[model samples]
Target: MTSTPPSPDAISYFGIEVPFMQHIGLRPLLLDSDRCHTLLAMRPDIVNSRGDIHGGTLMSAFDFTLSGAARAHDPERLGVITVDMTTHFYEPARTDLTVIGRCTRRGRSLAFCEGEIVDTAGTVVAVARAVFKLVVRQPA
Candidate 1:
């Protein structure tokens, strides 16, 4: 299905106000029923020794973006926790990165998601697949 960029309100709807997201300047650009997209600007603090974006940084974005997609499958906005994830690094990212995630399947209690990170040049730098467990947590 086609996915458009998320409106500002839609980004907030997905709850982008988190410490880690803020620290890395992660911006949720798109949010739809089965898809989500995010952008992370290149920063010196998040780069590795070789001056490329760190793997952990990309993984965090993947996890969050994937969960956002999975959350769309839940009308109640139930909490989703990553149960397991597998990521593959294809190249180093030297510029801003954009991540796209899609929920492949959603069950009553679990969801499967896939995501890819692309560099400023539109080259995919990494890919990830993850499983998340959907749960209803008591409000704080």
Candidate 2:
């Protein structure tokens, strides 16, 4: 399944507004056959008390990005429920960041993906792996 990178105006899986993407400072960096990745320019407002990008924010981004990847593989109308997720925080992200999620394996009913969050300088900040239960809509 060959996929092309979506334009900036392309709609995201979360149904996020294009302006909101800019507001959140996330740009769709790359979209490939089995992956959709985004880069986020971290803002102080999204940082934690320790001055690091909050873990929850990273997790949210990870989930969103992976779901995008899954959808790319199967555009059939469906919702993804994250059955399980595990994240490892390697280092703190203080500035601009990049989050990449790639579908490692896809099944008829489930998809597995892994993602990483890195600082602008290319240091790993966090890593996450998730399994999503893909629910396909049936004809009414």
Top-lDDT candidate index: 1
lDDT of 2 by residue, 52-128 (tens): 87787788778777876766665456668888889999898888888888889989889999988878788988999
* Clash number for candidate 2: 0
lDDT of 1 by residue, 21-118 (tens): 76777887888789989899999999999999899999999988888888875535577889999999999989999999999999999999999999
- For model 2 the local lDDT of residue 9 reads 63
Please report, as a residue range, the 10-residue window in candidate 1 with the lowest summed lDDT. Answer: 8-17
Error of 1 at 129 (Å): 0.3
**RMSD of each predicted structure:** 7.2, 6.6
Cα lDDT, all candidates: 0.84, 0.77
After superposition, the stretches of candidate 1 with alpha carbons farther than 4 Å from their true spots are 1-13
TM-score, model 1 to reference: 0.86
- The TM-score measured for candidate 2 stands at 0.77
